[model samples]
Target: MSVESTETNPLRALSPQDLRAHAAEALTRARERSVALTSVDDEDLVRQHSKLMSPLVWDLAHIGSQEELWLVRDVGGREALRPDIDDIYDAFQHARADRPALPLLGPEEARKYVREVREKSFDILETVPLQGRRLTEDAFAFGMITQHEQQHDETMLATHQLRKGDPVLHAPAPPSSRSGPLPAEVFVPGGAFTMGTSAEPWALDNERPAHEVAVEAFFIDTAPVTCGAYAEFLDSGGYEDPRWWSERGWAYRSEHGIDAPRFWKREQDGWWRTRFGVYEKVPAAEPVVHVSFHEAEAYAAWAGRRLPTEPEWEKAARFDPATGRSRRFPWGDEEPTPDHANLGQRHLRPAEVGAYPAGVSPLGVHQLIGDVWEWTSSGFEAYPGFAAFPYKEYSEVFFGGDYRILRGGSFGTDAAAIRGTFRNWDHPIRRQIFSGFRCARDARPSEVA
Candidate 1:
């Protein structure tokens, strides 16, 4: 697989060679993730009914099934390699908890299936024209399948985190913060800005048809709230205080006996949390992660602030006051590099807060692109003129107030799949994903100075 430069403008048309290169790289990444799973035994791979995740084998086969559906049948106009297996891998058809009960393909079978589909898919890629129908036009179908596989790779990584075993994955620690003492928050002088992407070629349906949104000036945290800051809230009886939580959040907390972020426990001398299979003292200076939206809200309320609305978050991330245009990323149009942000699983954990000055937004917000997904106040909804793409299950079914939006990507996120315009959503109570948040407040005349 070859490395391609970041599409400075994702909207532009790519040559056939460029599309093929992108497809090859995507397959390489998916294969690498699958190889990582081999470190665990078959028993671990087939384990089912784990909290909030599916059997690893299911994901493995599902990756191949999806590729066959899109690249082989849909794009290539070829017959289904295995029509009977489609029902088994349909994500919407089976819940995660129920997947283990079904007759899932074993590890070896799953590997063979994925390999076969990938071989066929590459053959299709070599011959398929990069123009004509909407799916083939600009090779959207291939790009979509690549992103789907990468997204599942992230899910598989999360499964590794939830699995009970010795650590099988390793990466060097992120660089320490070069930032000195800075203001706790920055004021975003709000105005109208383009909130979504209309031109981004591979952008999903929900992010399509960019529209202008007017926003009120708001004060937002300079960086994600750190573990140290969250610890302060916990020490102040944050979980115990109903005043700090919403009615629903309070009830959920009581029902679950939830106190601190998931995986956290207070040791006799200090706080510690499990990472992969290892336990270590919680790093105070790092951005607090594995938090739910409810926890983030309670922390914001405790601090006399609130979670930024999705628009506010976008403004902070992409708005350039000088150019009056939203850049592809907080830093600029350049693709994410190690120097730009802690992305692509280069590091297993978030770098310290206030790190990655190069990745900071024009408004001085730090670590806005990676480290952890920051929860916002807005719920998932369709943009103006929204239309479902090749399928409705991708984004249409999930549109509603049920899921809160999270911006930025986590350390495990593939850079190819994340952009400033990218939006992630989940139930407010989900804590397993690498999530954290920063506080925001409506800008007041007195506070602006």
Candidate 2:
């Protein structure tokens, strides 16, 4: 149906029957996609594009191993079909560029592994009740695994397009702000509001049991801080300000000597950045992507603003229902269109801020649901009533300290996987994904005078 509605009511709340059906559908899709590999030659297989992503072969294996690891090993089947799975396909364990080629399962072997894992996962889906304690844990883990594989599938498509160097018209972007400055601000009159979403069946350990949080009224930039805006901060020596950076952020900057955005290079005339394996001059109005939290904070401080707290951001995005909170997405229950947000490989890059006024949140915030994952002031920690599901490794591993919370979605986000309720978190120093920030303010009480 609608984009927002679909995202809000994704199969996360599915019955075991639903899970089984979805798994079957996904398996069929994955297997069909596996056949397409025959078309890609050796020349296409080894072509390295982004430093962050691996080759197409690695991606396929990783997805297979993922289904095997979560569904077969952890769920219905106690045994792993591919015992050497971790050594062969652990994407997190080794960088694609640094590590040698994997054991390289032939097309037949890969298909076998994929089939076995799919069957076993489906078996669990059929029998396991989707409600109980262990089921909750197992389902979330599989859910994450599923969403993750879906992400890689999109990446596979990008890599193919990059290898072919497709025409830009086929991948047109959101309206540009090259015409002029974007809208000034979107104000949210804040109050006590529930933060996070958990009423549904399968929420990540990070977004658990929705909790009530209070936020002061404040104004947030209608769009994410743009490259042109951030460039001004750098030109004015924003990085040199100790007041702007946290201790760890400063150390990271100094050690790496990060003077500008990760993809940027200074030219005699102006700054330029690489996009999808090609270098292009920086567009002033486009939302800044590929920025670390440290860079966002430095720019915010330079502008005399601050990043919104996760609660503040949540309040801006979700509309509380009288019976219980239920605003599916920012622009309401409709699915995303080109006019609402830049998502689902529509642009495959950040667009100018405030381009989608129609997608503005109830509080008037623009692009809160997409363009890029916006960094918040809050760290990645559990909500008040948080509990660990079967997947203890999901969010608990990085609690109390290192991880930072980012609300909203990005271009890479699946249309079905994004909602006002969805929460994505990452470590502060990490900057590989498409992420940026919007500024928020701490409202002050009016004086008696």
Best by lDDT: 1
Instruction: Compute the lDDT of residue 313 as modeled in candidate 1.
Output: 93
- For model 1, residues 1-449, the per-residue Cα lDDT tens digits are 00122225743555678878876776778678666765578888899626589998899899999999999998888988889899999998998988998889999998888888888888998999877788877667877887787788778878888877678889899999988876999989867887787667777788876788899889999999999999999999999999999999999999999989988999997789999888989999999999999999999999999999999999999888877788789999877888889887788899998679889999899998889999999999989898999789888899995899999989988887788889999999998899999999998878655
Worst lDDT run of 10 residues, candidate 1, spans 1-10
What RMSD does model 1 have? 3.4
All candidates: TM-score: 0.96, 0.79
What is the TM-score (0 to 1) of candidate 2?
A: 0.79
User: In TM-score terms, which candidate is top?
Assistant: 1
Clash totals for all models, in order?
Answer: 0, 6
Assess candidate 2 and give its lDDT. 0.69
Q: In model 2, which runs have C-alpha deviations exceeding 4 angstroms?
A: 1-56, 72-80, 86-112, 115-142, 151-170, 175-182, 240-243, 320-326, 333-339, 447-449
> Which residue pairs show backbone clashes in model 2?
2-335, 3-334, 3-335, 4-334, 4-335, 137-390
Give the C-alpha miss distance for residue 345 in model 1, angstroms.
Answer: 1.4
